[model samples]
Target: MILVIDALNKHRFGGILDEMYKLRARVFRDRMGWDVMVRNGREIDLFDQLDPAYIVALDGSYNVVGCNRMLQTTGPHMLSDVFQDILCGEPPLRSATVWENTRFCIDSERLKRPGADRTVSYAACELMAGIAEYAFNSGISDVISVVDPAMDRILKRCDNAPYGYIGKTVQMGKTKALAALSDITEERIARIRAFAGITGEIFLEDDVVADALAESTPVTMPVALRDYCDAQIAGACTDSEREAALALQRELAGMYRSQPSCDA
Candidate 1:
């Protein structure tokens, strides 16, 4: 199935959120045994109310499938509120220039359906691509995702680790580990598509938007924040800090290039 990607305004998102909660309850609570709260067959979190999120993936009839919740680092996120131990100790929470990519999970029952692979992969790729576009356009410098260690291996093999990994491996479950990524890359994206057996181009189709998304335009940042990032990248900071800066910069650049205008 060809996956569709659409940005929902806050009003439209209410429905998506409802669907996502049901899906999450099914996958995490009933299936995976996550010990999460489920009410009327729906799972939710306090952060759900506080964070601005995007829903990804769809079922055969075009219902929501796999979904990932995201929040800017300006707000409390995974590294800050939940997975602080996952960071290998480089200020697990960045003050700025970062976004927390969280709540990435797939609905397995939905996955068992025909053509589910393409739908899931397309949704994942589309969401990542769209996030990259939004980040660059919004002047955000980086996007961060904390994932399981096994998945991190897959991601590293795919060459998607261009942004860098600052988090350490922590047990989410037996055979489940959590790690973090600074950004997404073309090579990594191509690998993920291949892994899911998806074949086709998924770049955005608009040149103006692509250019704005891809290029490193001077965005407004506080002088101290900008200098700190530069200094960290230049090795004036600790090794971990340098790594964080490098990852953040790479993520920002890759996202910028993934825009439709930069596709050429």
Candidate 2:
């Protein structure tokens, strides 16, 4: 349901990511009218180039249904660089243990479809739970996001309410925006799980999922091997070196192509 993508393995899931970006364009630009940048049908900005970790949601058919972006507070981020007004009079938060979570959105159309694997409410809760679990496991002490009052209430209702707030709420676009502070704790995660009736793991390891998919889909390779081969090809300084690197890539491509389909 949830796939955590960082700078490393993102290349392996390019199609899914395109859907996520398009979803962002719809939510932030068309729906919320936040004046976000949408280019070539994908919403992207400077923050995206900073290599922030992205948490993405997928449905039964592997459609990108939800997503969230996380960035270390010690570096450039939305609240610190773009939406600093949310800080009110105080300085922006900067810490190795605190991460700024932004671009939190879900695909309204897809999640509401009939016979979908997850409803919108459950997907949202799962995403929240995934974030909480990821943060707790990563040694992050806190996560912050600039959200409005309605979102605040939703968080509270979902049992993942922010323990504290920073700065004051002010009108940003259609609603008031404020800095929301949430502590990474087991209790919060438990409450979210209880509310959504979600048990077991919320996050799927990217590598493991890729490996499984590779087994089922011929011509698809695991991300690690693909990345290593790509690096070798890019770093080749001579014709022989280039052919050597290309040999492994060609052999694997043929091997994968020869595999019988699961239905077979």
Candidate 3:
């Protein structure tokens, strides 16, 4: 199950740090060619230490497969410090209760199988839902995300979209789109939590155990179906292989499209 721990540096970091570093290097340095600070086969950065980030997905072997980062607007953040040049003015999340979303990466290489797919999606939903619950309990009402149109769709699918615009997007590397809370709902949160089969006193709105999964941590998929994902990741197997991957990706993309939003 996806665990959402605060100040996770003290604990969860130990379990997924290495895997996260490797995944970052592969995607940022090797694949995407984004300049990164690497030392001794590890990607090190100032943001890692300062940001109150969340690492979301893990495999059965406890390897990290997908993750995202967030920072409060208090200190030097995306608005005043980093991407200011690309921003039109003050960051939308600057004046209110909001968490700045950044560097959301999915280790597609690791997430090639069915197990990986379910785990990644589940983790994302849980993390977003958990954040919403935390915000509600803490008396904070806004969860801000700076993303592109593509990512905005993804967040909406998982149920985190902006209520209004705080700042407009100019140009930040790519066209950046920002979304705020108000879009988070109790019903959507319950649906996502139920799907993930998370059981705990999460300080959330009430819901009940409905099935065998009431008290258990849910796995994204049955073990048997992962073989198909594994085969696809290993490379195209036949005429259908490529078609299958494309179709699956489109399906996943559609999930994001379901909840559309304007700029944050």
Candidate 4:
């Protein structure tokens, strides 16, 4: 499932964005050997301070399997500021209709396991489709990105090729980088959906689905804990004693709820 997480609605996701940062740390630092800042196993940078929107891809269990960030071009973005060297003296493109895409990555190790197909990782393609849909709906027409050669090729293969390029392809970290432009159109979205075998909307639509799922799903708490709580409530002599037992049960349930949905 795809989630559009931003500063305003981030509180609803419960550390999902932190999981995305951990994924970025593994992909950019361990896998790609990028010079990035990773504190407590999470990768974060100045661009994140700009309050960019994140496209987070989660598995059936809500594990963060893929992710990307979108920032408007009128402000400081990766391509315009951090990757200014790629522009090679040319000024970065800034327009209201255009946005910047960065940190596009998928958890290939997780995808290679049982439920996912390695050759055509649907999570990656799903992210692309999510970007197209979210951008078009948000009034964004195009996006600028500093993509590596491998990602550029993947974009082409997925029928979401960059419409144009700007500046020289310079070496950035362990990979060569070049600025790319991708137009958000219906045909492009349709092509991506076809390639990824997506039949319906991939978006999970904020906390509505999450809240509904929680409400419908049956909770199977440990019988021992349930019995203890029941016995305590039953033996209580005063109303305050009964309230205390109930509060304890609720507190324990809340502890479980606050735990990470799945490890990154």
Q: Model 2: per-residue lDDT, tens digit, 137-169?
A: 899999997777877898999988898998778
TM-score of 4: 0.79
* TM-score of structure candidate 1: 0.59
Candidate models: Cα lDDT each: 0.54, 0.79, 0.52, 0.80
Give per-model TM-scores: 0.59, 0.80, 0.58, 0.79
Error of 4 at 1 (Å): 1.6
lDDT of 1 by residue, 1-264 (tens): 222223333332233455677888887667666656676566766566564555355543445667776676777776777766776666665645677776666666676676664454455555455455455555666667766654455445543453566657665543444646554445445555665455654433333322332233444233344334444443322335435765775665566446655234
Candidate with more favorable, higher lDDT: 1 or 4: 4
**Superposing all C-alpha atoms, what RMSD in Å does each candidate have to the true structure?**
16.5, 6.4, 16.1, 10.7
Task: Give the lowest summed-lDDT range of ten residues in model 4.
Answer: 212-221
| Local error of candidate 1 at residue 187 (angstroms) | 6.7
Itemize residue pairs with steric clashes in candidate 4. none
TM-score between model 2 and native:
0.80
lDDT of 4 by residue, 1-264 (tens): 789987666544434665788899999999998878886677878787677889988877677899999999999898877888888898989999999998999998888888664333678899999999999999999988778999999999998999999888988788888889989899999999998788887898765644543454355235456446645543444446646866886776676666665563
Where's the lowest-lDDT run of ten residues in candidate 2? 230-239
Model 2: lDDT of residue 171: 74
